[model samples]
Target: MGAVSAPPLFSRDFVDDPYPAYAWLREHAPVHKTRLPNGVEAYLVTRYDDVRSVLADPRLSKNAATSFPGWRPGRTGIPGEHRSGIAAHLLNLDPPDHTRLRRLVSKAFTPRRVADFEPRVIETADRLLDAFGPEPVDLIRAYAFPLPVIVICEMLGVPPEDQPIFHEWANGMADRSGPRGGVGRSVKRVRGYLKELIHKKRLTLPADPVNDDLLSALIRASDHGEHLTEDEAAAMAFILLFAGFETTVNLIGNGTLALLTHPEQLAKLQADAGLLDAAVEELLRFDGPVEFGTWRFTTEPITVGGAAIPAGEPVLAVLAAADRDPARFTDPDTLDLSRNEGGNLALGHGIHFCLGAPLARLEGRVAFERLFARFPDLALAVAPDELRWHSGLIMRGLHELPVRTSSPIRADYQAH
Candidate 1:
């Protein structure tokens, strides 16, 4: 049979529900190559093993800025001053440098440290639920969003009181508009706020000690603790805010929604509480928080999947669909929490695996446990289809989730 010579395999219909498009590609165009609306050609890597190998391949460097010509301008979402601002982080760095920088910060995010943060994470989660009273509320606004914002704020040595401002900056940056446009207004606010916050922290550092948190550590890492460039400091702070808050927001929101829609499984979870960990893992795998892995641009003529994608192209791996590929699992579509932990690409794989994996998992499990325990009769206050998803681009999240608690008070309503 001849190769399918179609246009982009995915259209509006596909983005709306990419599974069928992914299934089609997996069966017929596994190594699909196509151009973007912006005139960029990309090699879309599907299939579990192929995706894994491609991400792990050293041949495909991470520093797309220089290797892939002119790749920088459009990709960052926020352009201009903040373009360079965001570009400085480790996400864009590859190999020895990526290794070094990640190693320095990696100590703070270790499993034991995450466990230590559990009390704080749970406290943040509980306080958020507390705000909703005993009434059903929009879970995103009440629980998922604020909980992470507070925890990340504290982690970075920023005051919890500034959460609203921090959230504005993150939403600005994540919205993918240019810094001068959608994000800049918020970036400006975050930059401005961080500048003042940084100034205060410098005069009187937190009581948690120099090794207490990520911000102080990064500040000290710079030349003699005096050479951290203003932009560098602001950028790291910005990166921490966005990375620390957004992923968990979606995981909790999407994971909760998945449970509500799949009542039998929800019932099972309520019954066995032990399945909480597995359920969170499966939610990550089954529907997963992220729709696609962060975009990667090819530097050289990289032949991936089955096609020879030319150099300087943008490749996006649809993590959500790839997780459900039959090639990798049995009954991939079903949200079976009992499935083995290995059945997921949710945290991603290889070196690019999320640096904040431990924290995200900790927040997720803790958030679910407290939410369910607080409002045992928690349920959807609106129709499932009526719930709006924060548009499909860089992130996937619910605009709101209203829930109702059957009782005004519970025996164990203590904030963690």
Candidate 2:
């Protein structure tokens, strides 16, 4: 047998199916440095242990402001993050600041709160699924995308009518292949809307505002001397909405695809609703929405997977690759709903772990349960090879999932 050749990185083909290349990197060069699409040179860590260590490593800082000079934000950093005043969120800050900010919003996403939001999630999922008839429809547009957007909007106290606006802006920004100028415009629009929304909320807030929604809680915190500024509030809101929905959108989309393609797994899940929670975890580990962890910079010299990295250089831990690492997972490529293994870096690991994870999981479980229950005959409208994936580095998701409730699912289809 010959060694596998290095797969092209960030090309259209690679975007559609990046696992082969990731597998090669894991085997051949676990910590390899290469130029990213944005033209920044960074170390790509592909092993499971290395990714976890790198993510939790204080030497690999998350604060982008201190990155080496001449390094542009490109797709890695949010557009107009500083000028538009949305740069103070969790993704960009290191500790103390990160700790303080996370504390303020932590109450909204606690396990108890997320569990309490279950009824709303089920109602929202059912409402969205009801719109789909027997005819073929793009599930991504009709179901997967809007469910999370609407849920996040509810959590943030945004009016129901404003959700469509959020859907448009969020869709625009997630399209990294779209015109750069267009993405910037979408970012500006979101920032402006958030700033105004914060101002409007502040005026109507009661003497002791109830913490029903996250934004209201943030405003109350700011007013009560938590030192959270107006910009910080807007920044936090922007991050929560943007990060919160996109992940669940992909989770529902990707997990559905996983189930639909893997008939045995699908049947196992269908036969037993009790397996829903474990299935969600397996789905996340099998093909998670997060492809790579957010950009991290080497705060000081460090060694990762035998590769010595210098200070002030960019680094990316391939989350999907790490989750698929053979060293950590048995038959890593196979999707087993009953797989009892843990330690998937899908939401993330350590202090920087995704704050919205509990919400995302609850949403994923409810979304899948409702989706299959509503349309047991649901099957792919197109062949697996014909599907297209989003060409973004940070997240993994399908562009569209055409499905039909009228036709019986094909049993012999190969899993993607």
Candidate 3:
């Protein structure tokens, strides 16, 4: 029903619905040169197995700028020198550095660490829901955004009153990525904020050991000479704060939108709490938050879907397409809560796989479980079509989901 023959994979239309474009490329030109808005050559790799292979392949480094000379952010003449700093956040690091950096804080993200937050997550979620009032509420403002914003704020040891600042920084960072956006201001502000945080940590070493948080962990890592450079430490903290909130904000918002759109499955979920995890996974798969995975650059010429991928070109995998591939998933477009068949690129795969996956999942399950349970009568406060989606090649999420609850019964019940 679609173009089985290879077609131009770089059109704006393809960027919007890259699945069909990806399918075409997978069938025809797997590795083709295309120009970005900056006119640099990039390779778009679309096959599911191929994406996995490429991500795992050591030859394609994430730090493509150094490895490949011409790569540049769209129109941001922010010299390649500055690009590496922006890119060095864990996502861009490879090998010994990546391994070392990840090790420094991996313990903090463990099941034990995240699990300890369950009670707080539930409490915080319930409080946010309770504050919903009787009026139609924007879920993003009410809970979706605040919860993760709050979580990351807490994780980083940001002062109790300091969430709004971090939230603004996250928005600015996202905004800067926009075509005509100005991020210099945001970058400067966030860097200043993190520098202050580092200063605070240095001045006040923790008196108690177990009160350790992400900040303390990073501080400990840095003090041992295994210490990251000041810039590296600040960058990691910045990455944690933004990545933590932005991803979860989308997960909860996107998941809720999916449930609202598919009431039957949602109703099934409300009826049986046990399906919550799978339902979250299903939502993550059906209309997952991330549309594409991290960028990859080919170090050597390669062939995929039978087309030549020239060396030193960027290769992008349409993760959204991989999730919906009919070849791997039956009725790829349909949302079935009962089906246990599992496959998704939502958390990515291989070495660059999302380090915060467990925390995101735990937060998601908490958000949905408490959300539906609290607002049994929750229904869209505005027309479904009225909702707005944030524009991004990477994020998939609604700007707001206004839902209202009328049932007094929702409040009378307690899982606590």
Better of 1 and 3 by lDDT: 3
Candidate 2: which stretches are off by over 4 Å? 1-5, 73-75, 222-224, 407-416
Off by over 4 Å in 1: 1-13, 37-39, 70-72, 76-84, 133-136, 174-180, 195-211, 221-234, 341-343, 414-416
Looking at model 2, report the run of 10 residues with the lowest lDDT sum: 407-416
For all candidates in order, the CA lDDT equals 0.70, 0.84, 0.73
Q: What is the lDDT of residue 386 in candidate 1?
A: 74
lDDT score, residue 239, model 3? 69
lDDT of 2 by residue, 1-416 (tens): 12555678999888887889899999888888788877777788999999999889988778777765546555467666765667778999988889888887674456786777789889888777767776799999899988888888888888777878977898887776687677778878888888888788888777536647767777776324675667888888899888888899899999999999998999999999999999999999999999999979987889888888988988999999999999999999999999988889999998899989988999999999888877787899999889999877689999899998774433443221
Candidate 2 clashing pairs, residues 3+ apart or interchain: none
Per-residue CA lDDT of candidate 3, range 263-326, in tens? 9988899999889889889888887877767667778887766666778767777677677767
Candidate 3, which segments miss by more than 4 Å at Cα?
1-41, 73-86, 175-184, 206-210, 222-225
Query: On a 0 to 1 TM-score scale, where does candidate 1 land against the true structure?
Result: 0.87
After TM-score superposition, the amount by which residue 106's alpha carbon in candidate 2 deviates from its true location, in angstroms, is 1.2
Cα-based lDDT at residue 144, candidate 2: 90
Which prediction has the highest lDDT against the true structure?
Answer: 2
lDDT of 2: 0.84
